[model samples]
Target chain A: MAEAAGYDPLGAAGTWRHQRAKLVVYTLLCLFALYYVLPLGVVILNSFRDLPDINRNGLIGLPHSFSLNYWSLAWDKFCVGGTCAGIEPFFFNSVSMVVPATIISTAVGAVNGYVLAKWRFTGSEVLFGLMTLGVFMPGQMVLLPWARVLGWLGLTNTTSGLVLIHCVQGLSFTTLFCRNYYVNIPDDLIKAARIDGAGFWRIFRKIVLPLSPPILIVTVIWQFTNIWNEFLFAVIFSSGTHQPITAALIALSAGGTSVHQYNVESAAVLIAALPPLLVYVFGGRYFLRGLTQGALK
Target chain B: MAVEPVTLTSVKAAPNHGRMLRERLATILPQLVLAPSLFATLIYVFVFCGWTIWISLSNSSLLPDYSISGFHHYVELWSNRRWTIAYTNLFLFTSLYVIGATAIGLLLAILIDQRVRAEALWRTIYLYPLAVSFVVTGTVWRWLLSPSTGVERVVHQLGWASFKFDWLVQREMAIYTVVITGIWQASGFVMALFLAGLRSIDPDLVKAAQIDGASMPRIYRRIILPAIGPIFISVLVVLLQFAIKTFDLVIALTGGGPGIATTVPAIYVYDLMFQRGQMAEGAAAAIMILLALSLVLVPYTIWKNWRERREAARG
Candidate 1:
């Protein structure tokens, strides 16, 4: 992992002092890693443990008894806020909301990026600046207006309404990602395509679209994870069967009386977290790229 | 010459009227393509912000009323005890969270940059928390921090019967649990950002410092950290925003609780707007949150732009 560029030559081969320093470094790294992974490991372990075992052993211990029963129970049988339909419907609500929001926002953002980057019109820079302001606008600032707007549009308390919110809310981020990327694609390419009598759509389809996959992946992962995990909007805009997994997870964990169902709740939490976690594991490079670019820019 | 003839032939082959229409369409195509997003963004940014600002200044309650009012809601929001607690909590959370996360992140980044083995594996472990939602992070931490079922119980079972890790239930200390969880979820992100910044620093500077017999710590303090100063600012800004928008994390973790001890501006906004039907004050609280964000963001943006312009001019 040591590249010549940034590698410290001071920590050269075969010195006890250097070796001791290395040991300290590794130890610290491992300790921090344990702190980072402990919660996830505990959750996974408790999800399969029997409730009695969890109760006896406490949440932080290794399981004494294991069963797959709670996974299915959390999926289909456990009641959340008096509804025994489990997390299945809310999971579907998230999926249905996330997929379209991701796709639509990415598609629109690509075109917006292409136009802003390649087809500079008068005042387009100012327009781009104004649009990017949406990136920093707090979600709280928009809730009242959105409530009124959704009411006006007859979209209150529906998954479709959440989908609309995500799309519009995600536009600035998606546009920023794609536009920064598209800026790197030489203008000469677009000009050449144009001189060949390729119209705007044709150039976009043939030239720009081919270069879009990297940014598109980043944008999609970003949008998917963000929209899926969004709680404030999900909690406020939809409820009951219409609620997304995040809000439902809150209700599920907060709802029951008597002894807390640690097993099922752990399983449900993992289920809610699974999609984005899978995306991160598979697309980590793009995910980090999106994060860095999104933050630094 | 070859390209010129091809273009001329294409122009000649197309019917004049059809070609003009196509030309017209092509001229407008980019704008047409951009129209919807532009319209949506304009509404999302300008219109929504304006509407909220207006509502905050109005007498709206239970529902929005369009009649103009003064800063009555803002006055009410400032004078309220819960709002005061929430705002103070926000200030405390932002400072501690930002400092704690950035310091830990920078430390981790420096450690990893020492050419560690299995760097990718370590990075993945550290950063995976960021992939999960704040809700998930908060919920999991809540379980782990709760005294009855979590760390305290586990420690007690290990034979320390007098152990007490019950910050989740203690009103004055409940906010610190949120801080701890916030640091856990976000510090790794700061590490990733700092790691990238560290990797981009010129190697020759480090080599020269080493040749001058400067120790590693001295080299880092005097040379490497200064080189990545811009990243520190970026990290600060991002973490500040995260701190300000800390809704779901606190909601899932403590529910702003141990009796309103952890109530943040976002939670307060939600309560007023939705639960209590105080829309105008809610809007005002929301605007306060917005104001706090803009106060941080606006100057940073202008400074960033000015710095970029200066760099370009220098180049």
Candidate 2:
């Protein structure tokens, strides 16, 4: 078996055979990439086109002219729900919901994770396991009861209500992330601090918190993206002025029974998507690492 | 100093007591930190699930009732036409979405592994969809696939007047539009996982195969794919969980329309519980979803535990 084949099967780079293969690979990749990119491109392009142009040029055709009318309308004038105010107010609501939820959830997860990873007590693993199981639970499973709970607390239809639900739900994932990351930290540092008469909080503040920026980045990015894009809870719990970008996006796009305004809908979609899009672009590897580890691990 | 000798034992005992108290506090601190999350999870996951079970069993309507009852709602749920359509769609969508995402993801990963230029650009292009909310994906895809205004209209305008891609409006073909959007959204995630798996494999394996007259496809089939089998299972588990809980996408994309053609269990659960105010039947539908998730997740948990034990034993 070792002596049968003498030549290199892969061949040198840029050889004719390899070139043909390269062409095929690039072509296929470009085609699929276009599949993903074209819709987005169309959204951006169509966002600039006025309603008349969309009707004349078709949704995918090159714009004969461009205008900023749709973006402004989507942001400032387009009616969402009963409010004639545009997505701007809902954008603020989402920020109000997402910021607190992300910070609070990540903080809770970090503390829980630090304890679960470093300060292991009896049945700690079982506790951790149960928490992780919450991550897999479908939102529908908890929706009705959670809503009742929120309503009982008089927090329903408030940004704070959305924050509370997201924080509660996000804990499992944040805990999982922080705990897994902390597992790789050497135990000796903790023991050394313990020998020096440090307690749990002191050691965590001094030793663990400093070592946490990486996991915190992962957790925050994950939570922010999730809470921002969340629809079901936001739609059900919040109404009127408190709806987030996602829920508002739905109301805006599906607002009219009249002819669907492709331009305004495209603009609204892009506006709602902008924050997460920016995060994905800038957060880069942290986004991928967070999602992959969050899913697979 | 000499007079202090009698008090030395008491003094030492005092410090010892303080130390013991401090140690006990340290021991309790972790549990205290962990208590909120534990309590939340217990209430949210288990208690809510239990609540749904109770509600499903009761003859509750619009509001929860305390009296215990039989599986009347479950029976009704099973008999309902909408519920049946939703149940069938779950299986159809899950299978197609999972299979399509996995296949495309693996294909993209293999192509990108061939030392392609601009790898980062390609990866970003693919993975960007994962960041978009399902709401957005649904809306965007709805626009793209709509018959009168989307691709069909555009293609027709491009001078192929006979083109007919109106799956969004057709009752029978409506669900497949969801399948397409689901794949478009998830294939990038699948590809990322497969690419990670591919990158982790030793180059020597490929080299060895090449030296032995093995073609690229043969090498992938025999060696590369088998080695990454766990990733495939992981991807399937993830995608199935996604499929089972898919509501936002369907809601935004089709609104479960063309008259109940694209209803999944999640949408079904939401409609009965929230929209129709049929609390008992909705809880029944939700439990069905929980069971569907369990069908994938229970074995997954067992497999994970088994693998951990095996690894521990090896160590």
Could you say which candidate leads in lDDT? Answer: 1
TM-score of 2: 0.95
Candidate 2, CAPRI quality class derived from DockQ:
acceptable
DockQ of 1: 0.71
Model 2 interface RMSD, one decimal: 5.3
Each model's lDDT:
0.90, 0.88
Predicted candidate 2 versus true structure: per-residue lDDT over A18-101, tens digit per residue? 978888989999999999998899999999998888888778878888999889988989877888888899999999999999
Winning candidate number (TM-score): 1
Off by over 4 Å in 1: A1-5, A9-14, B1-19
Reference contacts preserved by each model: 0.76, 0.66
Model 2 superposed RMSD (Cα) = 4.3
In candidate 1, what are the lDDT values of residues B1-315, reduced to their tens digit? 444444566557857898889779889888888999999999999899999989888888997887889898888898999998998998898899999999999999998888887899999999999999999999999999999989999899999999898999998899999999999999999998898888888888888778777888888899999999988999999999899999999999998897899999999999999999999899999888888988989999998999999999999
lDDT of 2 at A116: 89
Q: What is the Å distance of residue A33 in model 2 from its true position?
A: 0.8
DockQ of 2: 0.49
TM-score of each: 0.97, 0.95
- Model 1 TM-score on a 0 to 1 scale: 0.97
